[model samples]
Target: MGDIFAEGVGIAGRSRTALAAFALGMSLVSSAMSFAVDDTPGIGAEMAVSSVAGYFLFWQVMATEGLLDGSRSRGAGFMAYAAVSLITSVAGLLGLVLLILPGLILMARWSLAGALVVARGSAVFAALGESWRLTRGFTWPIVGFFAAVCMAFAVLLLPLGIYAAVSDETANIGAAHYIVEFISNVASYGLSALISCGIVAIFALLVDRDERMASVFA
Candidate 1:
């Protein structure tokens, strides 16, 4: 059996390397969208949209950085990466429509494709293959990590959510609600960025461990 806790510990130890980059990227996207949505009724939603964009961007940067390891990528083949994601998403969606279990399994197995692309600079299909290979016997762990992330977020946000719900009809509701929402938003984004870093760290750790195991058995 794999030492799941050890994998988590290793990821936590390396989170600092990727956290700042993820946060900065997300912040920039959020701020830029904030300006665009100024005085808009749906500003919060707009900001959320931008933050999501930033999140994806941050992961790309993390993958690029992880693969190169402090070196610069002339170009990590962005078109290829995007194409890979689109293709996989479509297939995953179809699988989901056909069967929930298979779809989820496919999603988890292909989760590392982008990172593999960064690491190997290979074609999208090749990267997918690499991710699938590296994740063998580790799919459950990968799903568990995501579940852990979700649980962490849910635990943290439950109180705020309850407060918001309870206060919805009280006087000064707008002000208090905004306060709670602001805190909730910040907490959510911060947690999300942390999880993204953990993902990069895990990808790095997994590939490294697999390589070490291969060399040992060879």
Candidate 2:
């Protein structure tokens, strides 16, 4: 597990450019969603549809530009995106059972698997099988890694929370609420972007490790 984490960290450090691009794209998407929600409180359904569409489009770009060695075939990119989306959707549905524990695990595992499939030009089913096989003996370790990462993220948020609280307490006059809200929103956005980027790095690491192991055994 320590080795896995170390490898992941090293890969992430080396692939900083790709990870930064991905993270920036994610931040833009999230900011757009926030704006949409703020502008139209009752447009949740529209927002959901828009978000899904945007997610797929962005993911297609990521597949072509970042993952597939610069391949930009539209058909292949869309197919890869759809295949991954379908797998994750099915996993989400299945997660409903066992109170969704298994489903969440599958979702996280398949994220890496999807990247591998697209980047390596593997079939969807084959990728799923490989992911399951590779993750077989490391389930608990992966889970623990994710949990620790999430906890670390939460701890990072504490300072932001405190800043918001302090801003709120010190605010005065008519602009107090707006100022506090703006500050809090900005802090939240920044923190969310950082955490999201970390998760993407983690995904990249998992994909790379799985591929290396697969090659070694093959």
Candidate 3:
């Protein structure tokens, strides 16, 4: 009925505006971790640990203030959502053999549901239930929106991908050739993080609108 995606965009914008620093910090941490992994094997493990810490820290900031509803209950809610995501990711990875689409759908839905859990101060199951309910009549629209976004992102990254391919072919580079590759990877990681944050914001807006509409009706 309502323009759920438009609502998600607005909420995401506000969330991003409020938590820009956190997002930037997380992106930098993730990028550095990726760079470290490419450069050194031993240090890569340490960087990976640091990246996880940074991720949770960023989630704390976004969940506490960006959601505007769960400042006190943020810790529990965040943990719950994180648990759900971990399970989802693991299942998706392991079960990709049986049915790819189910795994992929679970992955996508869990992400939005995790955000919903934080924003709504609900349990992970409840967040998922809400997501299902909100998406009931708008599945195709949501899918189309995601496809469009993905296509746009692929187009935007075409030049970078081309350059990477060209470099690999022309230089015949090995993994030991880390400098340029690391730099390029970091740049790509940052760009991807920014775009991902934008997309997540859009979904957050949709979740917020669904909550508001349900409240009004009730």
Candidate 4:
């Protein structure tokens, strides 16, 4: 787990440029959408946009390891990833609404679906099934990782959260608000990149282990 997380950090570092572009573009869109919706209905829009952004980011991360090296098409991989991720996110969100533990467990189990889609060109259900199989024994560890990641994200986002709250209370919607929000969005996306890369690392580790075990048995 430690090694996988470290590798993910390294991947994020190496792909910082693409990450920056993604962050900037998405943040601008998010801010604009928030302004349009006055921040209420925008919540759902934000979630939808974020889901799509995550799929693109995951694909970019996997591309660093040669996602396009074979005959697999990018369009197909992306569509598969998008479908599976949407399903996972909806299920996880529903679980969270009912009981948070189920949501976390569901997320941990389906975390690798994105990687499987890009790496093996898996279909939506196939990738989800394979991810569940691969993550069976590692669910708790992944949940721990998720906890650590959420803490880090919260810490990084503290400035923006504080500023937003203060702005709301003081009615200070000025130029500085935009500046802070943009910076905060960048930081959030940076963390998202790290999390996506971490998922890729976990996928690679599990696939490698499976291959080694198969060889041993054969």
Q: For this target, which candidate reaches the highest TM-score against the unseen true structure?
A: 4
Q: Ranking by lDDT, best first?
A: 4, 1, 3, 2
Q: Which regions of candidate 4 are displaced past 4 Å?
A: 35-50, 67-69, 212-218
Off by over 4 Å in 3: 1-66, 70-76, 90-111, 156-206
Task: Pull out the clashing pairs in model 4.
Answer: none
**Which number leads on lDDT?**
4
Candidate 3: RMSD over Cα atoms? 5.3
- Report the CA-based lDDT of candidate 1 relative to the real structure: 0.63
| Residue 90 C-alpha lDDT in model 4 | 94
lDDT of 4 by residue, 1-218 (tens): 67778777787787788788788888888888868886668978887788777777777777776543366555657777778878988998898799988988999999988788877788889989989999998998888777788789878898688997799689898989878887888788778877887887786677656867999999
Q: What are the per-residue Cα lDDT tens digits for candidate 1 across 1-218? A: 13544644555455544555554555555445644765474576655464445445544546544544345363645556666667766877897699755665786688777666555566888888988988888888776665666578789999997897788656547776766766676677667665555556567667766777989999
Q: Which is the better candidate, 1 or 2, if ranked by TM-score?
A: 1
Collision pairs in model 1: none
lDDT of 3: 0.54
Candidate 4 vs. true structure, TM-score: 0.84
TM-scores of the models, in the order given: 0.63, 0.54, 0.58, 0.84
**lDDT tens per residue, model 2, 21-140:** 444554455445654666465356444553354344434433533545455343454465457667676765677465646755775565455555545656777777766665666676
Worst 10 residues of 4 by lDDT: 65-74
**What lDDT, from 0 to 1, does candidate 4 have?**
0.80
Q: How big is the positional error of residue 108 in model 3, measured in Å on the Cα after superposition?
A: 5.2
